[model samples]
Target: MSSTAAGSPEPPSPRTVTPAVETVLAFVNTRADGTGRRELFEDGDSFADWLAEFGGFGGFGGFDGETVATDADAAAARELRDALVTVLLAHSGDEESLGEPLRHAERHLRRAGSLYPLATVVTAGGVELASPQTGVERVFGTVLAAVTTFAGSGDWGRVKACRNPPCHFGFLDRTRNGGGLYCSPGCGSQVSMRNYRRRLRQES
Candidate 1:
């Protein structure tokens, strides 16, 4: 939230989920993670179902016992997720095609766009006008907006993807050196050692 020469500050950036956002994101990313493959977006039915139940931000098609059972394939999920995030989260540099979490990202953005309002007005008439109402879509929009704002404004240059190759989770890389790559210090150490070992073997 830096100030411009006009003596006014820019709008705050979107960011980490506040319990509410977390709940929705939890449901959203789950399909992509697929809990290590037990559940997956393998087809249209599964994907559509997943979107309806969880991916929809708890409101895509309404709550029901239906599960995503589409013949869509893994690639479809990956694609959808990535595209959604691309729009929902600003400057999300995650445009890779058919990654592991593509469709999840798409579901995320759609619901976000559907729910979260970019701006809310608070008139001076003692009225508190709201932008994002309550729901899954709102949650996604707010969280994604926070991420997008941070990237757009270059807020502390903090937003980053995990350096751990195996765990490519995105986060606000809050490190002093701003070089924190792995999601955790332990992962960073492991990756460093692994790289060093590989180099040693290469030299031999």
Candidate 2:
């Protein structure tokens, strides 16, 4: 029975979506906060609620009442999120810092499932990706498809993680040079101030 914020903007129409980048955005936004401490999918019930809300917003289907997420699903989802965070950090040029998490992410990603092209239909839009699975597999498949397609389209570098700790939100870098390093100007400013204070203390 949870609802969107009181003044939240309406989600874009599903028909207008290009799922590649949008799906990745949706998956990453599931975290209640950029800090990763509050997880939207902390359990089966919570996962179900998130799936319901996210599915409606993203216009994704196949995860209705019939799909049953388990405790294992919650665990896998968290693991995947952590792995993604590690990858984002690596993307930010810290590849040497999280080798093990990256490896774990790779293995799990390998098992996520596969995508096959669906016949293009004018009504349904042009050629689209589809997967023949359900439950957690479907979730993994959708996210992986987004990541792969986005990377193939050369937008891989545009997906970035905030440099600010405890607020590592994944965002599409729409900057002219794709040099964005934080989730928002606020985060960037906070980091800047913190760094400035630290340096001042060192000098003092």
Candidate 3:
């Protein structure tokens, strides 16, 4: 609920229920801002709270109902999120600046992607490959699966991080041309004003 002036349009609600994209966004938006900033994954409990509230795992086929996240899991989640932000930013065309972080993220993502084991399942419609995972594996597996599916289909580009500082929130770009640059119109205006002031200073 970050604001921009008294009557400006509010930032769009963070996307948190779109299959694998949901998992990516939940981690990305963990750093809360606006009234005050707080790290949503300060610990295992907080991370678990976020998962229950917005992890969006319910639609990722099936998973173990008993698995719970740990401190290590929280740390891992943050690491993955940091790398994802870099990769997503690079996708937005800043690969030069985000190169190192992108590499670092690649390593983590590659490792996490291996946790889920693929199996051939005979569904009523036909046969297809499915990922079967449990516990921590299920948690990370669902994310990796979603990324793989989306990236292959060209929808991954629509997932992006906002450019506004202190608010690098992740959002799904639903625009016609896929040119969204901010998480909200308010953020767009904020950056616009900042650019305008810079121009004024240069002119003066």
Best by lDDT: 3
Q: What digit string (tens of lDDT, one per residue) describes model 3 on residues 1-204?
A: 112234555524333235456656755777766637688877887776766665445343332333377898888878777777777776666544375677778887787666565554564444433457655556555566566655654567788888777577788887777888888999889989999999999999
List, residue by residue over 1-204, the lDDT tens digit for candidate 2: 011234566533322335566777677756656554567878987887777777654435656655578878887777676666667766665445367877876766656542322221232223345444566666776676667655655557677677777777877767776677887899999989999999999999
The model with the greater lDDT, 2 or 3, is 3
lDDT of each: 0.45, 0.64, 0.66
Ranked by TM-score, top first: 2, 3, 1
Residue pairs that clash (backbone atoms under 3 angstroms), model 2:
none
**Superposition error at 10 for model 2 (Å):** 27
Lowest summed lDDT over 10 consecutive residues: which window, candidate 2? 116-125
All candidates: TM-score: 0.46, 0.75, 0.75
Q: Which ten residues in a row have the lowest lDDT in candidate 1?
A: 122-131
Where does candidate 1 stray beyond 4 Å? 1-40, 44-77, 83-157
